[model samples]
Target: MADALTYGLGPDWEPGEDGLPFRRAARVVVLDDDDRLLLVRGHDAGEVTRSWWFTVGGGLDAGEDVRDGATREVFEETGLVVRPADLVGPVLTRSAVFDFARVTCRQDEEFFLARVPSGHDFSHDGWTDLERDVLDEMRWWDVDELAAAVAEGTVVYPETLPELVRALLDGWDGTTPHLDESSVLGPST
Candidate 1:
């Protein structure tokens, strides 16, 4: 419990016997005009030596609209102002059970698509202390690069991100794909 609070999980944070936490997050699959995707790199606070790459987003505020939450996450995490109306689709959804900051979180996440100009500099704004402690870097990724990273034993959440990004190369086809069944994310995942 002290570990959770120390990592800024909040005083209200408490997991059940199975370490089941309550979370609903939003993610933006940010694609630049050059076909590169934006992602962030981080690790569970207790496992700082091992890191994973994931899209830029976070949990929604209570009662927030989905797209609005998605866009808010984008701006807060990346300093990229994405209008809610400009986001493409809630193109994907997934259930993720993962460990971060020594807490096991079960997050139901929605993925939105945002298009940015090429080489929009990374100027993250308003990251909480937890993010500063766990998040390491933010970068633009090409699809093949992501695939290669995964192949080389790097953990990337939504393990199929490369494939999904490839499918969106021409634009989302008006269908939202569920990325996975409820699954734990890790190296073997």
Candidate 2:
């Protein structure tokens, strides 16, 4: 549910697949000093049972730089202020289509990497109404826990997220991966 319309993005919409509104977003894959990754749990607004875990980020504003947008989104969603310079490579680029808040949307997203202190403070003080409706739980997950969750059928975006995290934890290779449509997890059930 990283679509712009689901999180207070501008009204500027680009038509996408089958005339669905399109948006551009900047997402952050946040890792803590302890090597745990921080993610947020989101439930489809129209169907709470349709849930998944994703990184900390959301739609960017028109003309907003990706790194700036990523840091801004982090503060808005987690109450932690991150500087743009602190953000690492927009390590991944992706296109995703899905249903959120009852509307199907297409989004182009750039994912960046961030490292924060363990147990960094998080607050919902800046959430938009739509965000409050969909994003609820936030947690730091270790690789094994994420693997176990996925093994149990928990839905996570970009299906190979665990592997990506594992690789990043081992050390970023400086290559920007393109997670094409094939990587998107599709519409919520």
TM-score (C-alpha, index-matched) for candidate 2: 0.88
Clash totals in order: 0, 0
For model 2, state the Cα shift of residue 157 in Å: 1.0
Model 1 per-residue lDDT tens digits across residues 1-189: 333355566533445445565567788899999899888888766666878888988877778888998888788888888999998888999877766656566677888888889867766667877777778898888889889988999778788889999999998999987765456545211
Regions of candidate 1 where Cα sits further than 4 Å from its true position: 1-7, 10-19, 185-189
Whole-structure CA lDDT of model 2: 0.79
lDDT, each prediction: 0.77, 0.79
Worst 10 residues of 1 by lDDT: 180-189
